[model samples]
Target chain A: MDTIVAILAAAIVAGTPLVFAALGELVTEKAGVLNLGVEGTMLVGAVSGFATAATTGNVWFGVLAGMVAGVLMSGIFAILTLNLMANQVASGLALTLFGVGLSAFMGKPYESVTLAAQAPLEIPLLSQIPVLGPVLFKHQILVYVSWALFAGVSWFLYKSRAGLVLRSIGESPESAHAIGYPVIRIRYLATLFGGAMAGLGGVHLAEFYTPLWVEGMVAGRGWIALALVVFATWRPARVMVGAYLFGGVTIAQFFAQGAGVTITAQFLSSLPYLATIIVLVFISRDMATIRLNAPVSLGRPYRPD
Target chain B: MRTDKRITRRITGLAVGTALGLALSGAAYSQEPVKVGFVYVSPIGDAGWTYQHDQGRKELEKALGAKVTTKAVENVPEGADAERVIREFAAGGYKVVFTTSFGYMNPTIKVAEKFPSTVFMHATGYKSAKNVGVVNARFYEGRYLTGVIAGKMTKSNSAGYVAAFPIPEVVQGINAFAQGMRSVNPKAEVKVIWVNSWFDPGREREAANTLLSQGADIITHHTDSTAVVQAAEEKGKYAFGYHSDMSKYGPKAHLTATTHHWGGYYTKAVQDVMAGKWKTTNVWGGIKEGMIKLAPLNPAVPKDVADLVAAKEKDIAAGKLHPFQGPVKDNEGKERVAAGKTMGDEELSKMDFYVEGVQGKLPKK
Candidate 1:
């Protein structure tokens, strides 16, 4: 019972970053701009956040810096693909390569530095609930923030007037433009929002998750988040489920090894990626639903003449 | 017709310019500083594997001064990118290159063949060539001493190890640590978790937490991150840092660390190359050669335990104590080493089994 609670708690912690990044990407794709630079954006956010937190002794300041850095990084992608009319795939790839190199160079000074670990905020009374309290309530603030992000993103996408405009822009930018909606501007906003969320994901990693700065520390989580966005069919709720599922599988594998499971460590280590994809694929198999959820112009650059 | 004549004339002028430049460079060769290059698999962060190698590079720079100039490229991936970087160093007139990481073994050897005049040194690998040599420190020697400390300090009698891969080097550390722990406290056991990555702080932290939840009061990791130590610190548990001294990351929770010092070895290697005495050799130095040293024990450790560890460290350095000494048996109850015999380097390099006191099965390839 204790082990199950511990595994669930760990899954939430691990999945928080993915939730933030994937949700942000979901919005970006929904606005018809596929920002593949999620990895690079997260890296910049992570380094900047860690560096700020280390210097200011304020983790919140670090969070702000990370989000801003992420915005600026994605802003580059937005300009290249949206304004300059460059290829989206090429621009996104360049952003990732640039982010990897840039973060390494920027984080050189902070490599040896250490940060104080932030304690989780346990809700009074509510945390007394058996199993669920420890698994859900006992987590760092970012985990709660991620839950809020899921709720806010869901409401923003389905129940709001702006969401219809954004989704319409994603499905057919030309039609949306003909209807007098500012298509490119909405995409730029969506891309920047994605950048901010991706940055927060990185901040969660450098400040809250591991609380240290190391080059390539994002370590393909951004790519995983991007995959989650697609596999979840760009639905915000599914993205949340997929992220937690991946995190759960990752923690469970480690527990399995501790329990003397005879599975190869290599295979066990890969279980998270495999399990998340399989589960998400099985649930989202209906072709019509996938078509309805997927943004038609996701990776297409829009030029308003 | 006019353009053709101009192009031909330009080619002649460029050839003459190249010839004069080469002649000038040849004249200035002896007076120029010896160019040295270093390739690192991870960022030279404050602690862990690459940082220690970077420290050695700094020591080399300070020792040689103006006689040698060095360049270190950090966070270089261990495959095709490594080859390109190594070749660039050689092509850019670097006389000596140090490729620090086990994954660079094949790439170093391949690059050495193309750049015959350049000296290549790789770390923690078995392969070698006429121009490529390997240098590795016996890190397991320090691990055994730390295990002794963990064995003494832990109330739970279970130590958690977060390992990167099931490679021989990592396997040796796990087995040595188990042996040392059980030598002092027979009831003590080790639980192993493989993250399968040399550096991933998030996963490392999760693994450490899981180990702690499972009643492992002490923890250590083979991965290249301070996450385990930091995790132990946060959880109020003890931890042993690897690759470098990481007490600062977990001052309260850190017991001690098994640190690798490549400064002396690096300085000597540079000196050998300068003196034209460089050779392709597999140099595995340990406590005796000052390549591996135990970090100062935490004050929380009892005086008697510290003293015992100190004595054991000396025994290891003096060639009296072997981490893989006689009477060793695999977890499956199979005799790995006879009672009177110690494991040899050849067998040690191919180690694949977990010794007694390690609670999990060794993951197969």
Candidate 2:
């Protein structure tokens, strides 16, 4: 039972980055801009968050600092794709390369030094329950905030007027621009919001998850989060499911291995990612469905001629 | 119209010419410096794998004086990033690059091929080349001694190991620790929890908590961080430290650390290179060469127990002791290490099977 709770606890912590990054991408795609720099942005955010926490020893400020770093990186993407009319895919790739180099350089000072990840905020009544207490209520505040962000984002994307406009811009940017909705401005805002969330995800890793900022510590989670955007069909609620599903894949490997199941440990360790690829293949079986749900101008730069 | 076309053609020709010249010059500039670079999976703090390697790099520099210049990029990831960093270092005139991490084997090989003059030394990897050499510390010997301590101290007769990966190095340590423990405490059994990561402290702590909660009084880890020892301390349990003396992390918790003295190996290897006797060979040293040392036993240990371990240590140094001596049995009670014969380096390196008394399964690599 404790093992199950431990697995759930790991799920929330590991899934936090996915929640934030997926939400960020969800917003960016909704605004008609696909920022593939989500991975790079989150990596930079992690380094920035870790750098701050290491220097100041305040975990919250480190989180804010991470968000800012992520937002800044996203701003670069926005400028290239939104203002300069560069190819979104190419720009995102460059962003990833640049972010990897920059974060590696920045993470040099922080290698091997340990820090405290965020502490959990225990609720008096909820935290007293046997297994659920430790699993649900005993997680760091970031876990709660991530779920809140998911609900709030779901409401905004599906139920709000601004979300409607965002979706409209994504579907038909020229028409949105023609209708005087400031398509570029909305994209910029969306990208920034995405960057902030991705940055928060980075901080979740550097400050809340591992508490030690190793180079490449995000370890493709940002990319997984980017994939989660698609796996969830660009919907906030489904995003949660996909994130938790991947989290389950990771956490389950530990439990299965810990339980002394007779298998090569390497295969068990690779199960989460291997399962991801399988899921990706399964989801892509229906081309028409994916096409209909995908943002129309997802990887295309919009230039008002 | 003809003149305009000719001018456009001239501009295109000039652009191609410039691109070619830039590429050629970039290639030529890659051959500078007795350039040495090291790619570390973990950051170089005051101690650890990276720390020890960084220290060796410094030692190399001090030994060679102006003959050698060194610059390192730490915390490099194992895959493509490792290739890129090694290429950048090689391109920037570093002649020798040390890629320290198991996963860096293939990438280091690829980068070495691109820069033929650049020598690459990878730590804990099986692959090697004329330009690339592999070096590893014989840390299992120290683990064996620490296991003896764990064996003596565990009143509960159950010990826990928070292992990083099921790689041969880790598997060897787990088996050796179990072997040593069972040698002393006949009733002791070891339970292992594979965290699947090298340095995730939360996971390390979680693994420690699970082991402690499962009635394991003594714990040891093959992971990078001291988080396990810290976790043990918080729970008021006993545990052994690895790689570095982590008694500082949990003074009350650390029984003894199987500390790795990498500086000796580093200094020797670098000195060989400096003296122009650099030969590509597999170098693995144990207790005698001081590459591996056990940290001081905690004050909580009984003096007689400490004396017994100290005697064993002396025996190890004096060549009167071997961790895997004769008369060993497989888990099935079959004769494994025959009596009157000790296992040599060759047998130990390819130790794919477990010794007797190891309950858990060894993963297929």
Candidate 3:
């Protein structure tokens, strides 16, 4: 039970970055846009956040700077794909390359400088609960923010009238455009939103997860978050579940090692990727579910006639 | 996640095309200012492995003054790309190039085969070519000393070790630490948690926390990140740092650290190259040769314990103390070292057995 609680606590923390990034991508797909630049954008965000945190000595400022930097990165993607009608796949890949290069180039000086790790906020009465309190409530503010984003995204996609229009646009951008909805503008907004969320994920990593910016600190987390979006089939809540599940799989090796399990570290390290592939295979097997949840015009670019 | 960073990583090919023309102008001058290059696997991080190497570069520059010029390119991958970069340095007239990572061994050897005139040095790797030499530190000595202190200070009789991989270097450190602990407190045991990556702070921090929750009061790590020390700080637990002094990251929680000092070796190597006395010799330096130095003991350590560690450090420096001496037993109760014979450097390099008090078995190579 103690091991279970400890693992649960770590899973929540590990999954926070994925939750933010995947939720952002979920919103992007919901608007019929496919942005594959999350990794690059997150790197840019990570460095920018670290620089801001290191310079201003304020983690909050770092977060804000990270979001701004991520938006700037996606803005490049938006101009290329949305404004200039470039192929979404090629443009997204270009954005990732550009953002990653730019981040490493700029983040050279900030490498290895650490930000003070944020403390978990304990809710007064609620945090007094024995196991669950420490596991759930006593987390950095970003964890709660991720949960709130999940809730907000779910509510925004399902209950709001704007969400209805967004869903309709994702179903068929041409049809939505025929109905006078600004499909291109909505896609741009969604892409930028995804960028900002990815930035948050990167910042969460630098400020909370690792609290130090190493070169390549995001370390494929952006790509993992992208995989998480596919596994979730464009659902915000499922993204959270998938994120936490990946977290558990990722940390299980550590737990096994700590408990004196004699497994080789190489194989143990591969378990997370193995688990991801297995879960992705099972999740993708339900083609009907994916087809139902996936946006029909996800990768299709819309030019207003 | 995928190797996205590798795809986007910068190949910082900084070629300072200086007066190679003078050397090529038909005069074979051996004194034409030695050009040195360093291939860094990671950026010169604030205070880690690469950082220490970078510090050595500074020392080399200071010691050599105008006689030697050095250029370093950071974040270079250790596969074919490293071979290419190393060859670029050799072809571009760098007289000596140091490949400062274990992964760069084969590549360094491959590059050396083509440019035998350009001496190559690899760190922590066993393979040595005619032009390629190997150098490493007895980091286990510092680990053992820190373990002794941790053994004396811990109230819970448990110390946590967050390791990067199950490689021999990491395993040796774990065993040496356990040996140090058991020497001081026979009942004390070291718990092992492998983060699997050399520099993942999130995983390192999580592993440290998990170890603390599992009853470890003192923590140390073989990983690159400062997360374990930071985690120790927040948890109010004691910790010993590795690779670099990390007391700044964990002020009160830090007891001491085993830091790497490469300046002395780097300076000597460059001076030898300049003097035309460079050889393909393996250099395994320890506290005696001033390669592995310990950070100052934290004020939290008891005066007697600190004094005891200081005395042992002197013994280690004076060749009076051996951390992996006779009568060493593996965690499985198999006697690896007999009562009379100390473990030699050859066997120590391939160490794959945990000392008697480590919590886990050393993973198979």
What's the CA error at residue B253 for candidate 2, in Å? 4.6
lDDT of 2 by residue, B1-365 (tens): 99999999999999999999999988875533355567777677655667667776777677666666778787777898988998899898776777878889999889888887666788888878877888888788888888888888898888888888777788789878987898789888877778778866656765676677667899888877776777777678998988777776678888888876655666566556656677776667678888788888899988988888889888988989888899877666778689999888777777776677565566766
What are the runs in model 1 whose C-alpha is more than 4 Å off?
Answer: B1-33, B64-66
Tens-place lDDT per residue, model 1, B8-113, is: 9999999999999999999898778899999998777678788899999999999999989999998798899999999999999999999998889888999899
TM-score for chain A in each prediction:
0.99, 0.93, 0.96
- Winner by DockQ: 1
The residue-by-residue lDDT of candidate 3 on B264-342, one tens digit each, is 8998988887778999989999999999999988989999998888899899888888998889988888999999778
List the DockQ of the predictions in order.
0.58, 0.17, 0.46
Worst 10 residues of 3 chain A by lDDT: A276-285
Candidate 1 per-residue C-alpha lDDT over A1-305 given as tens digits, one digit per residue, 9 for 90 to 100: 98999999999999999999999999999999988899999999999999999999999999999999999999999999999999999999999999999998899999888888888999998899999999999889999999998999999999999999999999999999999999989999999999999999999999998988888899999999999999999888889889999999999999998776778889998899999999999989999999999999888877787
**Each model's RMSD to truth, in Å?**
5.2, 9.5, 9.5
Best first by lDDT, ranked = 1, 3, 2
As a whole number from 0 to 100, the lDDT of residue B19 in candidate 3 is 49
